[model samples]
Target: MNYVLALFLPPLSILLIGRPILSIVVFLIWVPAIIFSGGLTHPMFILLAWILIYQAHQDRRAR
Candidate 1:
């Protein structure tokens, strides 16, 4: 679900994963990067979100 969400909305997915500050930073950059670059930069954010999601899951498993 979140992977799919990350594909579409990386910042929101990141926020869901519990990183408000990063979400804000990604949001700030994602918008213009999308607009100007025509989504070429989107995969970067998606990858970032996916990594964060994976990390969060790992953290839960560790705890």
Candidate 2:
């Protein structure tokens, strides 16, 4: 679920994990990075969002 979202919208995926501030920050960085790098740096943010989503899910399971 989140993993697929992360591929297309990393910041939004991060938002789903409950980090509003971080999501805003990621979105700010992501938009420019996408434009400036011509999407080359996108994978980095995607991996980050995916990791955050995974971690959040793991935390929920632990609770």
- Model 1 scores a C-alpha lDDT of 0.85
Indicate the residue-level lDDT of 27 in model 1.
Answer: 88
Could you tell me how far off, in angstroms, the CA of residue 52 lies in candidate 1 after the best superposition?
A: 0.1
TM-score of 2: 0.82
Candidate 1's TM-score: 0.85
> Candidates' lDDT values, in order?
0.85, 0.81
Q: How do the residues 1-63 of candidate 1 rate in per-residue lDDT, one tens digit apiece?
A: 843553349888999999999999998998888778877987788889999999999999999
Candidate 1 deviation (Cα RMSD): 4.4
Give residue 52's lDDT in candidate 1 (0 to 100). 99
Name the regions of candidate 1 deviating beyond 4 angstroms. Answer: 1-8
